[model samples]
Target: MNAALKQIDAWQTSLAPTLPTLPGNDIDWLAQRRSEALTQFSDIGFPTRKTEAWKYVATHAIAKTTPALSQSTIVDSTQIAQWRLDDCDEIVFVDGLYHEGLSHFTANANIDIKSLAESFEHSPDKIKALLSQDISDANDAFDALNQALLRDGAIVTIADGAVVERPLHLLFVSTNTDNSVTPINNWIFAGKNSQCNIVETYIGADTTNNLTLSRTTINVADNAELTHYRSQRESKQAFHLAELTVKQNRDSRYNAYPIALGSAIARVNVEIILAGKNANCTVNGLYLTKDKQVSDHHIKMYHAVPHCTSDQLFKGVMDDSSRAVFNGLILVDKDAQKTQADLSNRNLLVSKFADINTKPELEIYADDVKCSHGATIGQLNEQSIFYLQSRGVARDQAEHLLTYAFINDVINRIQLDALRKQIAALIIGRLPDSEFIRELV
Candidate 1:
């Protein structure tokens, strides 16, 4: 057999012993879903270069390594203290399994939170309907694999007309360096007229070379509002792939901010559907890559009904030999009149060898709609650096300031004060002369 086939065979053989141990296996419907997902994964394996959505990314390395699923590890509280945010209700997952000891959050009457395993036991029918929904028409191997090896994750539900005062934080940490994979799946439901904020953070041990496959599904009911912040700062030796799927009802609103920094290879896919009239969405993202790391973002915004609106802005700063990709599309259906959509992707290549591939598309079948999409890829402006130098700033420090400003444009849009400050510090720490930059800021 060829190398790809061999890798696929290896994964199938390795996962056989653990299939029965998966959570929710005792439920007939859940077990059948898992079996179907596993069958799909076994048949198709991972995506290749021919896959349009993943054309810019190469998966050969991941296939060759074929990391095994990670086991729960004993993590110290001190190791994760730095990643925690203040005044937020936190849920912790270590090495893909829910870690109750490291997680603590105050309960609110309007909010209901439970682990996936707990949800299966208490609300099997609801979990079944959510998990059974299709993510996409085309077969996605990663999605299949995530469901097939399903473990523990978070399930959050907000009551109608409720307003949450504190943000909800879901933290996932990886401490294993034995070339393992961690799969996580989460669900969030916001009832009518509710408002809340959620933050999802992923971190790994610095020296570990693990893999993480994560998926989060969200539903916003009529007149509800949700702000979602996703921060990915894994180990530089690790691989991270994540997906965010959202459905918005009439008059619902969703705001998203995604920041990517640490990982050898990281990819995030976002899909949003405006299912009812007057739904709105805003997605702003930033990705900073250094060394030989690769970062990618794919977004799909669908306007299914009339009077819906969406706006997308994504920026990337590539240093050293790092690479990045941005693929965004806005689709307006035929009957979706009065739709307003816009998408823009801007990239900065700080190194001569650093590169970016960006594609922004607009497909509007409604002639009365207003939609636009565009992309820009360029380097730091020399004149701007010279202008800063003329003001008594050193050339290197001036460049650093400009780079920080480029990324901060999106970071500043975050409404949560504590989370914004934490994200800024993390971004500043990744720059050259971080301490000096921090002092200047």
Candidate 2:
């Protein structure tokens, strides 16, 4: 068989059954999407140095070879104890398979939170209505592949008039057994007048050539509000690719905060589609890297209707020989009049060899819309640093404090106080233990 056909065979063979919990959809549906997805995957399989989108941070290091798909394993209690949270209902997934014992879902009238596999069998109609309805994969191969081979993940659907008082935490840990591979496609939907918060985190207790490509789509109905917090702190040697696409209805609002601090090669692609009039959306991200790691974040907001608004701000701090990439694009369709969008990207490089690539683009077709974008890449303000040093602050301490303050601006915008403080400490602690800071302290 040809290489492509061989790949198809490998993927099809990976869908073998064990306990038959996944009452999967027809192969015809899967095959139809898979065929379309394969065409996209073939068009852009593991972007190379030649691809403009990946021109700066190449994936050749992680893509030199392909590893076999790993088998899903059970998460023993000893390992489950290690996963901790505060005042939150936790849903744990071990290697893309939901763990019932480790999960606690309050089946209240407020919301419907269940495993995708379970929903496939129980709520097939709802599943058929919303699955892959908001996420786009025609331009992305990893997303396309995820749609083609999705097996396990969670689906959070918030019903009207229900406000989840407590935050929903979705935790996925990679129990990479035997060095095989796996990825999960997920979705979350919030209904009209509903309010909820989501904290999705990815951490690896065990790492191999583990590569996770995940796609999450969220829909905010009329007059609804959702605050999403995502944190990535996986093993430094792993490869991670994540995409979040949000769709907003009239008078609906969506806010997203993504924090990246791990992986050898990581990419985050987020897009917000304003399909309804007078919708609003905000996108924010903070990435801290050191030790020659590479992190990339790409954001796109499309104003498909009139009287919508979008705001985006992304900040980064890179040290050692590590690199960061930020690309923010705002697109306003021709008919989308009176739209307002603002975007900005800023990066702080702390080392001589650190690299950062920032691009802010705006494509405006509506003449009356208000839109602007700006980007800046610079170091610590010398005057501020000198003043702090003059005030008895040690040189290293001054720089650390200044750097912390620079990043705190973005951190404080997170509306959830507990999660904001938690992520802030994570960002501050990311400052490497340099010889200079050590000696000064």
Candidate 3:
């Protein structure tokens, strides 16, 4: 067997003893689903460099370590406060398990929030319908693994015609003292004509080496709108893999912003389906990696119906020996006439050792559709840096300003004011001339 297959074998052996005790495993259907997922994962194993989609980054380091389940530990209030979004309803999960103590929410007639475990126990039928729906999960190893080991997460449902003004925050925190892995599954169901905003944040304590595998499913009914934002700031020793699957109905709108700031290896796979006519989807993402970290993003936007629109913009800033990968695909079916799609991936490298690989692809079967895709990888403009330096700015500060300006476009797209500022601060702090940037901003 290959190394990837061996790793899968080891993981299966180590995970077998804990399977019976896993939450929701007692349910026959859920158990059978988990088994099927495990078998699928075993067949594919981890995606290695040989895999076309995963060619740029290696997964050997992650495969070498076997992951155990994470346990709850004491988390400081300061750490929690740092991640809290102002004026938002919060659902806190520590080590992939929902924590009642740290979570805060109220009973709203128009909105309902419940833990995934509770939903599975109380409304198995509803949960099953949502769980059974898949958007390319079987084709991905990490997503299948997440399905097999999924434990707890938050599920939010917005009532029809109701508008939620405040954003709902789902915070996933890892405080693992040892090498472990946590798999979380979240669902969002937006009813017809309803509107809501969701913010999912992934963070970890210092020097955490845990692995987090997350899967999110979103369903938007006709005329509904969903603004989704996800940010990941984990320790450099940690690994993160997340898959987002979304299906939008007729006349619905969905906007997504994914930001990656920290992690040794971070990958996010986003799949969106415009399943109904006049549906619109937009995705804007930014990833900043320093040291030896690797950040990868793969996005697939499908215009499944006529008169649908989709747009995507992804940018990355890499320093030190870090590497980043961006692969985006826009597919328009033969019958999807009048479809409009655009995709752009741009990267900036700060060091000679840093690297980036980006590919933007479009597959259109309808000649009436308008689809455009492009990819760019380059350094800062020398003329722009010279102009800043000539204006009395220090050389280091000039370079920092140019780099910050490159990513500021994506930052400005964040709808939440507090989140936008917090993300800006985090990005500024990572630069070499943070003090100067802070003083200027």
lDDT of 3: 0.88
Q: All models: lDDT? A: 0.88, 0.77, 0.88
Q: What stretches of model 2 exceed 4 Å from their correct place?
A: 1-28, 31-44, 76-83, 123-126, 132-135, 177-179, 206-209, 432-441
- Each model's backbone clash number: 0, 3, 0
Per-residue lDDT of candidate 2, residues 205-296 (tens digit): 74544677777888899989998988887777777888888889999988888889888888888888999999989878889888988999
- Candidate 1 segments exceeding 4 Å error: none
TM-score of each: 0.97, 0.89, 0.97
**Pairs with steric clashes in candidate 3:** none
Residue-level lDDT tens digits of model 1 in 214-246: 989999999999999999999999989888899
lDDT, residue 439, candidate 3: 81
**Residue 35 in candidate 2, Cα distance off native in Å:** 6.4
- Give me the runs in candidate 3 sitting further than 4 Å from their true place: 1-3
Span of 10 residues, lowest total lDDT, candidate 3: 129-138
Best by lDDT: 3
Clash list (residue pairs), candidate 2: 69-181, 70-180, 70-181
lDDT of 3 by residue, 1-441 (tens): 876677899988877666667777889999888888878888888887788878998988888888877767877667789889899989999989998888888889889999987877898898887776665547778788888887788888999998999899999999985878888988899999999999999998777888899988899999999999999998899999988889999999999999988789999988899999999998899999899999999898989899999988999999999999988999899989999999989899999999998888899998898889999999999999899889999888999988998988899889899899999988988887888887875
Looking at candidate 2, the ten consecutive residues that score lowest on lDDT are 14-23
- Looking at candidate 1, the ten consecutive residues that score lowest on lDDT are 130-139
- What C-alpha lDDT, on a 0 to 100 scale, does residue 119 get in candidate 2? 71
